[model samples]
Target chain A: MSLFVQTLSFNYTKRSNILNDVSLSVAKGDVLCLLGPNGTGKTTLLRCILGILKINQGEIHIGGRAIRSLSARELAREVAYVPQATSTVFPYQVLDMVIMGRNPHLGLISTPSSRDEEIAREALTKTGILHLENCLFSEISGGERQLVLIARALAQQANLLILDEPTANLDFGNQARVLMIINDLARQGYSIFMTSHFPNQAFLVCNKVAIMNEGRILACGSPDEIITDSCLSDLYSSSIKVVSARILDKPHKEVKVCVPMLV
Target chain B: MVVAIFFTSFLFGRYPVTPDKVMAILISKIISVPKSWTDTMETVVLQVRFPRIVAALMVGGALSVSGAAYQSVFKNPLVSPAILGVSAGAGFGAALGMILYLPWVAVQLLAFVFALLAVAISLFISKIIGGSSMIVLVLGGMVISAFFQALISIAKYIADPLDTLPAITFWLMGGLSKVSNNDVIFAILPITISIAVLYLLRWQVNVLTVGDEEAAALGVNINRIRLVVVLCATLMTAAAVSISGIIGWVGLLIPHMARMIIGPNFQLLLPVSLLMGSGYLLLVDNIGRSAGSVEIPLGILTSLIGAPFFIFLLSKAKKGWS
Candidate 1:
């Protein structure tokens, strides 16, 4: 397993648990999409896995090494994180923002060297945003900013990438673009673990799907096996239909979509 | 530009020493040049103006760097060096020292100690309340600042209006006229060391501006880095305010100006703020002394010049920050 969790449980206070006994794993070259409704502890689970939140009881291992045994820098080298995009107070250049990924590799008093700049440039190229290198990060569009964040994570040089709502605020075209990039990274043998509200997105790129609700995983399997009409409808507490639709001029190909039916 | 301002500042006091005499007197220290200037001229230049000019540069540079670092660490562009109640605490200490009839050196020492004490109190309260979140620390600082300001008011209420009250009031107005060679030497070590430490951690400050959780995910030990930055910035602010009294606006305005010149990359912003702050205060000091018969206090002049210029910069630029 590229990433593994065993019986993880967490809570902010003793009165209630936010994530209860969650366990999952992702293999190399796999794209796992965690699906859940709002306020279902999906993000809390991700935080526990990233070591931001201490677990109440459980074990997490990255590449067979216990997470508690690794230092923060070591963890960063093993896993890269792409947080949701937000505006910054200062306007940093895209290249400068990307170069910040080299922080873990630097010493206490040292800055990034020229070789680190080369690595940042390579990450930018991989994300296909090399042309936006000189633009101010604040001046870019939201979708472009998301891509820049992904580039920054890639610059960490970690094989496992964890993203939180990577496609949340993007338009349809930008969503497709980001999903395609995720697919490409998985094809390049990188393990991807991401959380999303869109179940259709799991069908688009993810090979594995995990449904979480009220701090527990309801099911975990391949997308076709777990993302059913009943599972989503019950998970969302609404009526949802799973339908197969054929594309124009592509009758041989069909895709599954989740549609909500109003009373 | 800083060098030119440093040398030119020596020529513009009540004692009119010619530019050539200024150069001759400055060079005479190194080589054996015959003294063509009067004893009073030499005293005015070397003993009086030299220490004051050096104090301006050191205090200005230190305050600006501290402000820039605080702004980054707090992730708020409006943050100044006085955000943590250091200035208010120092002001109260200075007031109490004056009312107690302490000597000038003792007063400055008390101010430095109290400044650090105030920050410690703020940090302690923050730890108890919210465990190290920036907003909680800021609120803690606000409470401490208000408390210190009240203490200063009490000290003023009991002070002798004829003697101690005016002295306390003047000191609070801020100036460098009384700074001697010893005061400059005393403050130089802490100011220089703190600024050097901050300069080395410039890149980490950039990461800090990305917010706490994000910075930690990027492998930064957020608590350790925040503590170091806050300690260094407070030390520099305390030392500067102790020597020059509460000179305001340099801390808040110079960083914005530096950011305007070059965008907010601390790699360049730190050095730029240091140099610009030095030159700005020197020029302001020149105007303060030569523009009138009696030297105006630096705090008043800085506010006078800084407020209008800040407004102009804000109105002219589309966005002061990103």
Candidate 2:
């Protein structure tokens, strides 16, 4: 197993818990998608796994070692994060932005060597953005920025990638592109964990799916097992329909998609 | 440019010494040349001009680098060294020292201590309020600044009006005239050490500008790095303010100017700001002394000159990368 969590609980105040008894795991080369509505403790669970927030009760282990025992540098070398795109005040170059991922591998006073820069460039190329290496990051489109963020994670060279709302602000075409990248990364033997509101995205890319509702994981299984019409409707507190549909321009390769039914 | 300005400044003062005579006096210190220049010339060159020039350069570089460091750590391009209440705290300390009839060393020491205290209070306030957001820290700074400013006002209200009041007023307006070799020597160590520390950690500072969550995600110890950088920056600002009172605008403007010339990479920006700030302030000091018979205070002149030049640079400079 690349990541394992057990009975995780968190609370910001004395009034109520934000997350209670959430447990999940991801093995190498597995893509796990977390599906939930807003404020459903998806972000809280991710923060707990990242060790940004100390959990009140639970245990998290990466590669069989307890997460609490690992220093930030050691943890960072094992798991990389791709945050949702936000505008930076400074217009750092795309290459420079990617080069920042090398921070975990460097010493306190050390800087990125030419070799590190070469690796960053290689990551950018792998993400199909080599042409935009010298462009200002602020000038890039939302989809390109997402790709750049993935490139940065690649530069970290971590086995497990934790992405928060990777396709949140993207257009339809961009969403497809990002999901494709996640699937490709998973096939390359990397462990991928991501949160998304789009139910069909779970069907599209994830091999494993978890549906969270009211601060807890309501269900966890393969997409076909968990993303049923009744389960999604219960998770979202609204009527939903699961139907088979053809994606892309291909005549074959039909896939299941979830569509919300009006009240 | 700083060298050229330094030599040119030697010639432009009210008691004009010719360029060759200035050069001879400078060289005579290194080698035993004949006594061609008058004793008055030697005294003006060595005593009056030397310390003033050094003070201007040091204050300018220290303030600008501190401003740059603060801007990065706070992740706000608009922030300056004064954003943390250091200047207000130092001002209050200096006024209190003056009221107590303390020596110059006591005044400086009090200013440095109070400066650090003000930042500590701001951080403590932010912690008590319970958030890691930058806005909380800034709001805490503003509250602490107002508190210190009010204390400085009370000090001014109670000070003896005859000699001490004018002295206080003059010190507050900021000038290099009162700087002696001893003051320069005292301020240099802290300023130099702080700037050196800042330069060494420039890459880490760059990582910080991306914001706290991202910085922490990248494996940086955000709290530790920010505390160390803030301490060094506060030390430099307090040392600069101690000797020159509150010379504003240089800290706020010079870093912007440096960023305009070189992009916001701190490895280049920090060192470039040092050189650019030193040259700019030295030239401004020269203007203060030679522009009229009465020397204009540095605090007034920097704003007077800096504000318009900044507007002009804004018009002419490139967009947002800085």
Candidate 3:
């Protein structure tokens, strides 16, 4: 397994536990999408697994080694995180921002050399953003910024990738583009652990889906078995439906979509 | 450009030395040139102008690099080297030294020590107040600065109006007129060390700009790196203020100019800021020395010159950063 969590529980205060016995694992080349509603501790779980938040109970292991045993640099080399895209105060060029991912690979005093730049360029090219290499990050569109962040993660050269709401601020077409990129990365043998609000996104790219509700993993299995209409309704506290249909003029390929019902 | 300005500064002073004489004096120091230079010329070049020029360059470079480092670590472009109360603390210390009739070295030492103390207090208060949010740090700095500013007022109030008050006021205005070789030597150690530390850690500083959570996710020990960068910047700010007595604008202005020219990459921004800062201040100092019969103080001249130039740069630069 590339990333593992066992019986992880977390709480900011003694009275209210933010996460309770949450357990999940992702192996090499697998796509695990954590589906939940707002305030359901989805981000908390991701933070705990990333070692940003210390869990009060249980353990997290990256590549079978206890996460606590590794320094930040070591853990960063094992897993890469792509945060939601936000505008920066400084107008860092797209290339400059991507090269920051090489932080884990370089020494304390070492800077990104030509070799590192070459790697960053390759990552940008992989994400189809090589043309925006010189553009200021602040000037880029939200979807382009999201792609830039993924390129940054690719430059980290880690085997495991963690994404938080990768499609949150993007338009529908941009959202599909991001999902396609995530799916391609998984097919290329990178393990991905992602959190998303849209359950339908799970059917598109994720093989395994976990529905979280009220700080607990209510269901965990393949999307076909776990992401039913009722499970998503319970997870989000709303009426939702799961339906299968042909997408984009492809008759043989069936796609599943989860839509929130109107009251 | 900096080299051109540096040599040109030698010709503008009161005891005018021709460009050829300046070159001869400079080349004579390195190798065997004839003893054609006068003793007064030698003293003017070697003893007076050399130390003054060196002090201006060092102070300017130190402040600019310190400001850039602080802004990156704090994740606020509006922040300057003095944001943590270092200048106010140093100003109070210098005023107290004048009131006590202390020596020049004692004044410098006290200022440097209090500058560190002010930052330590700011950080401590922020820690006590709870989270490590940027707002808390900035607020803590404001409180500490106000505290030190009040202390400076007290020192000025009680000081002898005849001698100590004017001296304190003059020092507070900031100038390099009294900068001796000893002062330059003392400030160089801390300033150079801080600048080197910032330069070596410049790339890591970039990681810090993405904010705390992202920085930690990238495997940076945010607290440790912040402490180191803050300490190094504080040391440089303290050293620069101790020698030159709170010359403003170079720290805040040069980094922006550098960023406008080189973009936001600190590895390049830092070196560029250092060079631009030194050259800008050296040119300003030359103007201060020769502009009128009575020499203008550096503190007044930097903003008088820096503000308009910065505005011009802002107008010409692209609209990217908000």
Q: Can you tell me the DockQ of model 1?
A: 0.66
Candidate 2 residue B275 Cα shift, in angstroms, is 1.6
TM-score of chain A of each: 0.98, 0.97, 0.97
True contacts kept of each: 0.58, 0.46, 0.71
The CA lDDT at B274 in model 1 is 95
Off by over 4 Å in 3: A246-252
lDDT of 1 by residue, A1-263 (tens): 88999998899999999988899999999999999999999988888777788899999999888888887778888888998988788888899989988888887688999999999999999989999999888899999999999999998888889999999899999999999999999999999999999999999999999999999988999999999999999999999999998998999999999899998
Highest DockQ: give the candidate number.
Answer: 3
- Candidate 2 at residue B222, lDDT? 84
Which predicted model would earn the best TM-score?
1
Check candidate 2 and list the clashing pairs.
Answer: none
Q: List, residue by residue over B155-239, the lDDT tens digit for candidate 1.
A: 9899999999988888888889899999999999999999899889888888878878778778887899889999999998899
Total clashing residue pairs per candidate? 0, 0, 0
Per-residue lDDT of model 2, residues B115-208, tens digit only: 8789889988988895676788899999999999999889899999997788788888888887888888989999999998988888888888
Lowest summed lDDT across 10 adjacent residues in model 2 chain A is found at A87-96
List model 3's recovered fraction of native interface contacts, to 2 decimals: 0.71
Rank candidates, DockQ, best first.
Answer: 3, 1, 2
Tens digits of per-residue lDDT, candidate 3, B236-271, equal: 999999999989888999998899889888899899
